[model samples]
Target: MTSQDRKDGIPAGGAGGEGARVPVTDGLRFAFGTLTVLPVRVTRWDRAAARAGMLCAPAAGLVVGLASAALGGLLLLAGATPLLAAVATVAVPAVLTRGLHLDGLADTADGLGSGRPAEEALRIMKRSDIGPFGVITLLLTLLAQVAAVSGLYGESWARGAVAVAVAAVAARLALTLTCRTGVPPARPDGLGAAVAGTVPVRSAVLAAVLVTALCAAAGGLFGISGSVRHTLAVLAALGAAQLLLRHCVRRFGGVTGDVFGALAETAATVALVVLSLG
Candidate 1:
């Protein structure tokens, strides 16, 4: 390991930087290239660059949420059923991200449900095919998301759109927490290793606070009924993300690329569900 690797627990062998510096343009490029199917040219692949990219991930989510809200709102305006509108909204990010997060969620569920040693479970996760556990988890999670968002849209389009945006932003914010310092990568190479332990605890906390405040502010902007309840729903989603983080830490011994995806999907789903119920 290089000195930088030892210092940050990140894999080495990329463009050298005496100290990590993330230009806004490079960060945006990396975030878009990694998180979405958008055609963004990424010129950097080093540890420092990857860390910078992860820090800007939420910006990608903001774009995704805006698109999702637009689609749902359009569908509603066309007199589509609430269920159909919800499905469209849910599918928007899936398509934009190439269902990467869902794949992560499935792999994670399959791995953790295997009841095997960590090494064996990791092997299971690395496989290309999905398993029964993954199938069941994906089915249930998708159903819950569809049902909840559908109900919310059935009530009001503005409220549903705002919730979608908030959930997307919150989901990406969860990544900052997941990558905080001391979190080990699942492997010595790959996406997880490049980003693991990159985020400082201070940065993670600040991101969390900022995301919460933004989501809460969204409730009022959208004229959601029971604005307090909407804010609480965002908190609930964050709480769920925290629980998943703890579970991954315990089950896998640390965070992985799949874990990050799983957290994003789970947090987004929980946020939508809570908002729908409210």
Candidate 2:
């Protein structure tokens, strides 16, 4: 839809047959998209309006993160194997974010994984097919996550699930931060654009901090004690993720959906590893 139409409160999903079809504002679209994907309606898309859609980014991240955990749980329960579990998580998202992370992975791969100049690598990323760099990046990240979870599950399955859940939450929280916190646009459109359309940085910062607090508490499960220490670890993880993301964004000239995915995945993996070691 046109930006003007979006501004005019044209519903992304237009009028319905049965009842009053309140025009879905671009403001609320991501939140609506998020809620619609969940198993429960505990939080409705309409609720996001109060927060000016900043919550939507984190909320959407939460859903995907949780979905990853649940999917991971099912895989572990069924003895489905770690690699298989990873595959399931990717496959399960019916509305698959149009290869959101895959695109980032590809672009980043083109830029970093490939030995070519940055401009040429980025051009290669824009291609639909995968390159050797893209393939390797995807494989390595997937393997890293699967291996990390498998190792955690070996130690404590509950902790592993918690790791997955918290990571999911954290990753999503990352999105809110990126969208709201003065993230310059990388592309004119795509995930970054939509995020720009929604969350404001101030609200994102608060929400991200709150999420970090919760995650730090989750960190305690790794044998780290005291809420204060745990919170510090969580903040540390987030701080590290921020520094890492900043570098990646600067390197790429902007973060894409894949970088968003990669950042979340990397942070989650790091958190779980640190917890396990703790």
Compare the candidates by lDDT and give the number of the best one: 1
Clashing pairs in 1: none
State model 2's lDDT.
0.54
Report per-prediction Cα RMSD to one decimal. 4.6, 6.9
What TM-score does model 1 achieve against the real structure?
0.91
Residues 79-188, candidate 1, lDDT per residue (tens digit)? 89999999999999999887878988999999999998888998898788999999999999899988988888888888788888888988887876777888888777
Over 4 Å off in model 1, which ranges?
Answer: 1-18, 222-227
**Could you tell me the lDDT of residue 249 within candidate 1?**
78
Off by over 4 Å in 2: 1-54, 74-99, 114-121, 219-237
Candidate 1, residue 34: the lDDT equals 77
Which one wins on TM-score? Answer: 1
Q: Write the per-residue lDDT of candidate 2 for residues 1-278, one digit (tens) a residue.
A: 32222222222232222122333353355443432343322222232342344465455655665676687678778887765665565444323344454445556666666666545655665566777877787777666666666665666557666666665566556556665546654565444444443455566777777777776676666555634444654555566668767876666677655556565555655554555454
Q: In candidate 1, what residue range of length 10 has the lowest lDDT sum?
A: 1-10
The stretch of ten residues in a row with the least summed lDDT in candidate 2 is 3-12
